[model samples]
Target: MSKFKPEPFISCYGGALGAGVDEVGRGPLAGDVVAAAVILDPAAPIAGLADSKKLTERKRELLFVEIQAKALAFCIARASVAEIDRINILQASLLAMTRAVEGLAIQPEHVWVDGNKIPTWRYPAEAVVKGDSRVAAISAASILAKVTRDRELVLLHQQFPDYGFADHKGYPTAVHLAAIEKHGITPHHRQSFGPVKKRLEQLDLF
Candidate 1:
């Protein structure tokens, strides 16, 4: 998918100037949930835009820069681990998405979210399932959110190399599970998450 021209079919109920939104790190045991909103520019077409999970790190990095340079406007935002614990992952994810949309350099007429659920917001918004793969602007948002979260996790890795955050980006991979088993939980881990909560339970059992 190269350039996505905003069509009436795409925003059947939304206003003009549609902004796509997506979130990353929802399944991670650590790191804040990151979200991004992007309003693509029809005049400046970006090539090779796809779901960020499908793209290699190199491809994502390349597109991350291109998206920022070519898109009409984009914004990345996050909900902290603490917020996730307080409000739960789903709400925190939406909050981050809402924040991302609000931070846009150009206010969008409507927010096109990449999932079945839309956040609580005053503006008009629509949720399209699998939108990251279907919508160009949503794909751009996925790229930015994923790349930004991964970059931040790498920084956290430097401080806590034992968790191998740089390699797994705080996901619940085998290596990460092993690291958690050995090292226990850190402040960075989302205590509200199952694995982290289970780990805390085992510790309390002792």
Candidate 2:
């Protein structure tokens, strides 16, 4: 009955603990959509909390550890490139967030989701714009998601040398576009994306 935060998600749900959810890799041309949910301890002090995009990799890695050590519960989940292409990126992102939240050992009373749109889930959810920076729990979740996804993309770089997955993490950078133009798309590349679609058109292939 209490009013939620004016941000994307409502504050806490009734009296249940507040869980924050966030994701990364939506804009990538390759790699999976990774998401994380974190429940921060109300008693804990949240220092140095900020948006994952605002922090350096070292900072995010450090905060990630702190969040893991302090959070009441947390979980990370991913939806692969194939799933993204099949379900569409938006749905895949929501699916990834849902999986992350559901994987929590205990269900949260309310979930504060980052971004303007809320996912279709049975649990109570609050959609917060820029929630990652506004909410400590969401910020922690963002750090976890970004760090985990970035690490995976770094590993993928070894498998696909031409696209420089490690460097750009499948973003449609000039290098990535050039790689698509030269070698065409790999299984990891999202063929549905614009850059990949344009490149395939030039080659007269799908």
TM-score of each: 0.91, 0.90
Model 1 ranges off by over 4 Å: 1-9, 13-16
**Which one wins on TM-score?**
1
Tens digit per residue, CA lDDT, model 1, 145-179 = 99999999999999999999999999999999999
Model 1 root mean square deviation, Cα atoms: 3.7
User: Could you list the CA RMSD of all candidates, in the order they appear?
Assistant: 3.7, 4.7
Candidate 2's TM-score reads 0.90
Task: State the C-alpha lDDT per candidate.
Answer: 0.91, 0.87
Model 1 residue 193 CA deviation (Å) reads 1.3
